[model samples]
Target: MFGKKEFAMSVHHRSARFLHHHPVAQVLTVFSFWLIGEALVRVLGNPLPGGIVGLGLLLVLLAMRRISTLSMRRGAGWFLSDMLLFFVPAVLAVLDHPELFGLTGLKILFVILASTALVMLATAFTVDRCWKYLGDRKEREHA
Candidate 1:
């Protein structure tokens, strides 16, 4: 639907004002996900869902020091900002499934509520423990 001039104009507009401003961060972000995402979708008929595989790939790259936090800051910030929007589509899709809340809906709802509560509790406990461990380590180091 887009014409060549429109596409070229958009490119010029974007190129005129660099996103995130940092070249390295932009490069890493683009290289780590956008480039890989395109390749995976093109080469592999069945590509993994967005963010999931990209995140795993990013983590692997970070672990290997192929991409550093400094080079990922701007891109990471952009991703964090847009992360919630990505979940909106899935939520909208679920809303289309009104039957999911039919006769067995109550039971399913109960299970989901309980499991969600359990996950929250577990997450809270884990966070508390991690903080405690880190605090203790800091104190010990200072001692």
Candidate 2:
């Protein structure tokens, strides 16, 4: 006969193991957050896209320690690894627009390249600052 404590622990262990083994469930968990964001947007009549809201929500949850990074690691890794696939539709859609091959297209391409460079630079700077801040915090804690 199993004790109550043992039974609860057994259930928790089984659930943790199931989550660890099932990447699909992890992805669904991520998607559920997005759906929640979409519902919130619909209810609040916000102008921002659901995906952006969802990402912000996820970030806040992670920052506040409400969610463990490990819980989202596998799903986020899969999405990041296959991110190029997400842009395939946009690339294909460009073929349907003949004007994009002309001077207007060149201008758009230039803007895209410039914006990408700016975003990369900004991201690099932010990451470097965050790294330094974390390193300093750790050093202070140790001291």
Q: Which candidate's lDDT is highest?
A: 2
Candidate with maximal TM-score: 2
Q: Write the per-residue lDDT of candidate 2 for residues 54-113, one digit (tens) a residue.
A: 999999988998666777789888888999999988888878898999998999999999
Residue 119 error, candidate 2, Å: 7.8
Poorest lDDT segment (10 consecutive residues) of candidate 1: 12-21
User: Residue 20 in candidate 1 has what lDDT?
Assistant: 36
Displacement of the residue 70 alpha carbon in candidate 2, Å = 1.1
Per-residue lDDT of model 1, residues 67-122, tens digit only: 46655577677667878997877887758788777867788989999999999999
Off-target runs (Cα >4 Å) in candidate 2 are 1-17, 107-143
Which residue pairs collide in model 2, if any? none
118 Cα displacement, candidate 2 (Å): 7.8
